[model samples]
Target chain A: MKTQHEVEQFLYRQAELLDSKQWQAWIDLFTDDGVYWMPPEPSHRTWEGMPAIFAEDKNLMRVRMGRVLHPDAWSQRPLWGTNHVVSNVVIVKSSTNEVQVRSRFHMMELRRDDVRHYAGAYTHRLKKTRGGYRIKLQRVDMTNAQAAYDYVLQVWV
Target chain B: MLQERIPDFSKFVEPDRVRKEVYTDAGVFEREMERIHETLWIYCGHESQVPKAGDYYAVQLGRQPMLMVRGPEGKVHVLYNRCPHRGNMMCGDRHGNTGEFFRCSYHAWTFHHDGRLRNIPMMESGYQGTRYGRDNPECSMKRAARVESYRGFVFASLAKDGPTLKEFLGASLVAFDDMCDRAPEGEVEIVPNCFRIIQHSNWKIFLENQLDALHPSVTHQSTGRAAHEVEKMIEKKTGKAPLSYHMLSAFATVTIDKWDNFQTINHPQGHCILTGYMGLRPKDPDTLKYEKTLIKAYGQKRMEEILGVNIHHVLIYPGLSVQSPLQQLRAVRPLGVDRTLTEIWHFRLKGAPEAIYRRSLAYYNLVNSPATVVNADDLENFWKCHQGLSSDGGDWVSFARHFGRDIEKDGVVESGPGMGTSEAPMRNQMKAWARYMGNGK
Candidate 1:
């Protein structure tokens, strides 16, 4: 029984958690079966066709988290700093236990001498938890679908 | 005076060995762009990318900017991306449809999809008898020296004469075969998108590392070991570690002995393939359903044969690597002597079960995707290798591990066995490098 404004607050809160690199806290926001997916095709639906990007469950997300913190994780040597700005929040559909939401985001990631802006649209299927809500799926559609880019850092949407 | 000692490129390399400078030299990179990237049958986007008339995708080969477009007459054409009028780029977008013809962005000059001039804006009035006109082919976008397609994959060569595209691909054409054969309908669908990573290192570093069996356990040791620990905990708690752990722990769990158990098959034309590293076949319902569907599409025997084929990685040297087991391909485009761009793309096995595709997608996300820890480990080393090579610590980065132990049978070099320490793959690639950089003796 969360209002639309409350849902928007939840979205922005997730962004803040990411921006602060609160890795484990971010992991706690997902339901057990939640999926983290980013389609290589920015405009494609993950349910309708193959997803170029997919993290099926929490264990995969944990593995990603482990790599981010692992000392041998060489790619993060000069650890990257990110600003996740999630906006355009809208509740697409809602039920007693689950709701679908859509939003747009612009993320600025600074690593070494390179600064990249990742702008995209996101679709989230969330389940209402006893405490609050848990994410079931989050899909990211990037604007630069076809351009050659730096290797992706950890997961995002 | 430094230009005077460009080091006799010929004497520095033999058929089996090459000087490290061939990999870390700026002068050599310039020569490769002209002699190899420009002369060889360089791959462009697939035909499916430009399915409709007037559709085009821009690609760069060496210093030449080119576009692969579908002409109005239903033919795929490869044209230099520059407009002949004022040398402006024809299509600024990576891909788009020009409706019927290309209109230059700088000037309003229009050309047919096949690089034939269609209009000059103010034609007869502006240039009554001038050298420029709509009928002049020179006034249009220039086509590449040669363009051809094989089973829908497009490739263009800047050189007028060399081997045909097929001849150039040689055993390397297995990149296409391994993929197309896996398709139930004899086709694969491009994901319509890609992960592009620009590594601050020489392109050779990435290519050399693709088939190198030695670095994974060391480079990804921490990720692998951490994943392994979590996997054991998960197994104790849940009776099984999710496949994601398998994706990471495989790096740590696949002992040096098991790595030696696998083998690399080196072929001519710089193409090579490593033995399969995964045991993907299982008797699960998802797999059973896929096998049944494949059996129905192909025959029972054909289905069994296709499903049971064991393969893990294929290194189509000089540029591309295909992990058919995972339905992924990484094309290496060298940006400079110390810079490289890797375009990673995943494919879906057309007509396969959605779950099967998901496994491929998971593998794609796990091992090859930029988000994956496996890729992060690999990229870090590419940079470190570049930095280390640039140092004055040593004049040569040795490819001498298990050097003489390689077995040569019918032109294929086979390395025996070792865990996380075989330099054989590097030697094989450098061997091929020597041949390509060497004059055709």
Candidate 2:
């Protein structure tokens, strides 16, 4: 049985990987068929009906990772330095091989001396793997999902 | 303030160059809001936005906060959002049903969807015959000088009299026609909400860049190259790359010199249209299925004619850019001299299959969304352009490329042979601006 402390540690490790821009390690945390979604609005319950900020499968995620890691990605010419603070972690559901965890996150991103704070709720569906845990589905709901933004939101929150 | 600081409008705008103050000076920006935006037929919202009788969408037309609502008889009305009493905004939220009447939260003053006063609390007891009557036009919300819709696309004019919306649109009316004609049902419906992005640049810079064919290779080369590599990899592994990749990789493959192959047609009203460069009609199963449906609905010959309309982007003067082929549009709202808000909205081709709608959605997310690298690159250049124009290092912004190589027939300007990369759109826009500002008229 995986304890709450184990789940918390797993989430913290994932945050560190993303914060450090460890692209390969971060992508590795997702299963072969994993999904990452960020709905465009708070009222969005499914990704099918309306457009989303991001509703990427493994292939699209790989493309996004490639763009961010590429030296020529001008938007990320100097990569955004981010610190993700994950809290209020709760295991919403659990089984022998899979778990659904919900948590709140506050991400502080800095690039070109400009800082932006993004707060949101994250719901992650994870599965136990031989090496560790792989993300089955990761859904992020940004607090300012509906607000007009000054620039492109290039990072995952 | 700008009347004294800036030179004559004739000196500021020429056929091939424009003074930097036109894009950088705050005073000039305000004047533009008064002379251009306020005097033009600015796009408000789609008719589908307010489908129901009480539904409304709050929008900004130049400096005025306005609401586009549907009345009891299913007629659309555009009115200033200010309440008659105390001048508070009536609709606070971005959009919602006003429940048959709009009631101001501050004082409970009510008005019908058509902006006629419905009731004021205790009107008979509190006050009477003191210029607060229900019949007084001043006591109700002020309507726009004129409101009209062309093919479900709504536009409002603040000027009391001018050319009708049709006259203003002129040849540019094809933007809506081409979009609606694509749908098998011969109409379109909005896909609910849109992506509102605030760009830190002069609004003109955004409009000019919409038809500028010279920068795609330099600005989006990296993203395009990356997507190209992945697309090739996918083709090797799966025998085909998705259509979404072409949407990005085209930025690289369509080199600067090749951009000349696609011509831009300049219109009298400052509107411009760019001929399509990308081959959107892929022969995949999804596309084939969609084509078959179109053939059945529109017939083989009519379907070919509908799909054969080749256009990339159409600029509707100073305020809107429509990508009819992709079923997307962007409405430009100038908030300040250096801050512009763009509302990016996509449409669903009614009666088309789910796969066709998905294609539009993919284009929306990959090319137009604020989260995409393609749009990010454009945003960066917009900011940089504004920053450079603000500095004294440059005095004149050049539109000199292929300036003398444009042919005028009737009232429309077409690029000369092999001069498709010309800055005719920018020149044409300034010409119209000069006229509107009372310099060339």
Candidate 3:
């Protein structure tokens, strides 16, 4: 079993990878069957038949990263920059090979001529392996999930 | 006395182009709200949204705040959100049940679910000699002039005198029929909640893009190319990739010139239907099971006829855009001259298999959701278009692509052969707009 300090270190490193736009490394933090979910509503428990802001598997994540990183993505023309502050980490439950974690994040994204703030809580289910801990599922509940955005969100929160 | 200068609205629209003022002018936007949005039948929420009695959903119809409430007998009524007592708006929340009756929090005035006056606080003591009484209809909340539903999708018109909803819908009624008919139970139910987006552009831009077959290739090329690359890699590795990848890659696979294979039928009422191009009928196990279920519900030939109705997108005049094949729709509500609000809602085929619903969910998340690259790029273009139009860069927005080549038969305009990229839909919409704005009907 990993200690609380080790879990905090893992989360901080994950945030660093995201802020630096390390697409592949950020994705590698997840297992092969990992799911990245941003539910449209906090009451949404599953992504099977309900509409979600994002319910991507590994393949879909790769597609999203490729599009955002592409040359002709006009939405990313001014080049988006995000700073992430992940804190309040709490290890809800830990077993021999699995751990459930809860935390809060505030991401400020700068695009073109506007800055948008996204504050959310995350619940991560991590499975321990030889290399390190890999995410099995990451559920994001955004505070402003129902806000009428000025434009479409191009990147993950 | 200062004479008001009457603007000639007809001069702003020609047979092949429209003046930019039509999109940018505040006065023109006000006129559009008065003559087009308020006068026409605008789509309200689906009937399934307020399935139980006393349940209500708040919606905006043009500049008026409205509510769709299920009455005592499961009938849906559209009412103005204002209370008759002091004009204090009732139901400040987005949606909730009013319990037994709608009681105004300001003065304790109550109204029935159908907008009828139910009771007033201390009627005998407070207003014994006053004109206000239970018999006065003005004491209750006002209602929309007309409320109608087509196969469970409700629509309301503020104008009492005009074509009925069916007459106005005309050929576009197929949008609703095609959606509900595909279900095994011959109906669809709302998947509650929606993704509401506010685009910083005129509402017309969104309706025009619904059938503008030319921009998908140019605007979304990056997304398509990226998805295609990953799809090819996945296929090489796993021998076959999932169908979800093709949902995006098709944006690239179908090049600009290839878009000509699809066509649009532009109705006189400003509605348009784009022909289907997506290959939704793969012979996979899940699909085969769906087909079997459909065949069992609607006989073999009937099921074939139902599924064979090929449609990709349908624009219902001033407000709704329905993607019937995928059971999703986007309702446009104009918030201001330069602001438009869109509610993206999806539905479930009532009795279809779970896998079928999952497919619909996948398409909703991948294509319609605000997070997807497809929607992001489209929004960027919308913003750019609005900014350019608002500037003094140019005066006329051209719709001259194959203008005179369109074939008009029995008032229905269709693109000429091999002219699928024709701007006939926009022209038709402008012509309808000119009529609506000129006559004020």
Candidate 4:
């Protein structure tokens, strides 16, 4: 079982990997079938039979990474770096090999004079693996989910 | 002299043309929020958005905060996002059920889904014989001047009087009809959550560009060209290019001159329709199954006719662009002369198969979502256009393309046959804008 400190450290590590442009490392944190989700609704969401607001298996995540890290991704030029501060961490529930954790994240990105701050919370459904732990699911719903956005969303919350 | 309500209206508007300041001036923008957006039957949302009792979706009416909520009786209501007592805004969250009714956080004033005052704390003592009693209309949350729903979409006008929603919509009603009629079940569910974009340019810029029929082949050329090359290479190696590539490649392969091939029909009150370009009725299994389901829902002949309705897009004047072929509609709310809020929403055709829904999702993500590269390119141009227009680079932005070339008959305007690159739409929209900003209602 992972302790609060251990989980916090892990979350920080994930942010560092993303901030450092360790694309492969960040990509490897998920289980083979892990799903990444971003609920588009600012309020209640019952998509009925539809899959999800955004449900991407490993393959879809890979496609996203390819587009983001691709040299031709002019949107990523100068490379925006983000600092993710995760707080209010809590272990909603824990089991033998799985844990559900909820935490708030405030991400600030800087590309020279341009800076954008994305404040949101995340719920991670994880499973204990032989090595450590693998993300089973990551669900993000931001405070500004309904706000009009600028450019492409090439970064993770 | 004209009524004092609209002073200087003559200088800002004309029958044939108007000053650019109408779009670039702050005062004019503010006046529009009052006289147009708030006074007209602006769209609220779709019925599917709030399917269950207590479900609600928040939206903007000009600069005011408003929401669309479904009551226990299954009726949709549009309400101001404010509390009646202390004036604290209700439903701080973008959307959610207020349970049976909305209870204000400041003073615990509760309101029903119909926006009727339900309870006020210590009602017996706090009110007594005061005008602040629960019976007072002021005690309850206020609704727009007029609220009505067409088919499933909701619209509200702040002015208590004017044309009815249907009357105002007129030919623009086709935006919703074309969308829901295409669905076999005769309804559509908004794909929950919209990609809202704040364009640095004026709201009019985005609206005009929607069916401009001239920018896609030029502004999106580079990205489209890149996608087209890959599509060709993939087609060479394999026998087919992924549908996603064609999604992007369409921008590149469809030349500016070829744009003239599509036809645009301009209706009264600024509504316009662009005839079909994308062939959605592929004889694939998913589409076939969806068609079969539609046939079951409606007769085969009706189903065939619905599916055969060749419409790629419908611009529902001043604020909306509906892509019926893809089951998506975008709403525009102007923030200022230079800032605009746009919500990009996709929909699920009721009774469609999972694969069919997924196809719409693919289009949503590939072309409509904020993550779309196509959007990235378009946003850049919008920003640049705003920058250019604000500068002294030029006083008049030309809507002269294909001018004096529109073929008008029976009160509708169409461009010369063969090319969609006609500026008839620009002229049509401007005509409406001028009328709205002029002396006439």
In order, the candidates keep a fraction of the true contacts of: 0.58, 0.52, 0.81, 0.26
Ranking by TM-score: 3, 2, 1, 4
- Candidate 2 segments whose C-alpha is farther than 4 A from its true place: B1-7, B439-441
- Which digits, one per residue and each the tens of the lDDT, describe model 4 over residues B1-441? 336656566565443455667668787788778767787788888888888888888888987899889988888888898888888998888777678778888878889988889998899997888888866899888887788998888998878889998998887788788788877778888876577777778888888899888888776665576677666766898878646567777877888788888889998688899985576777777788888888888889998888888788999877988988788888998878898878878888777788777767777766776556566656667777787777776666677777777889887899778758887887788777766766555
Which has the better lDDT: candidate 1, or candidate 3? 3
Model 2 chain B: weakest 10-residue lDDT segment is B1-10
lDDT of 1 by residue, A1-157 (tens): 4568878888888888888888789888888888777666654555434545554567766766776787777776775788988888888999899989999999998887779888888788889888898889877777764455675665454
TM-score of each: 0.87, 0.97, 0.97, 0.81
- Best candidate, DockQ: 3
How badly does each model clash, as a count of residue pairs? 4, 0, 0, 7
Note the DockQ of each predicted structure.
Answer: 0.46, 0.62, 0.78, 0.22
Instruction: Grade the docking of candidate 1.
Output: acceptable
Most accurate candidate by TM-score: 3
Lowest summed-lDDT stretch of 10 residues in model 3 chain B? Answer: B1-10
lDDT for residue B150 in candidate 1, whole number 0-100: 74
Better of 2 and 4 by DockQ: 2
* Winner of 3 and 4 under TM-score: 3
RMSD of 3: 1.6
Off by over 4 Å in 4: A1-108, A119-151, A154-157, B1-7, B13-18, B233-238, B439-441
How well is each residue in B1-441 modelled by candidate 1, as lDDT tens digits? 754554556665654455667768798888788777887777787777788998888787876778899987789999999988778888888788989888988878888888888888788899888988876668878888999877667888898988898887776666677677677887887776667778888887887788777677778876787788778878999887656578779888876556676677777667777776477777778888888888888989988777666677788767878787677888777888988888777877888888888787667666766566687778778878888878877766777767777777887777765422456677777666656665434
- Maximum-lDDT candidate: 3
lDDT (tens digit, per residue) of candidate 3 on B1-441: 212454778999999999999999998898889888998999999999998899999999999999999998989999999999899998998889999899898988999999999998889898788888887789889999999999999999999899999999999999999999999999999988688888989999999988898989888888999899999999999888778788889889999998887788999899999886568888889989999999999999999998898898899999899999889999999999999999999999999998888887888888888787698888889999999999988999999999899999999999888888889999999998898888432
Ranked candidates (DockQ, high to low): 3, 2, 1, 4
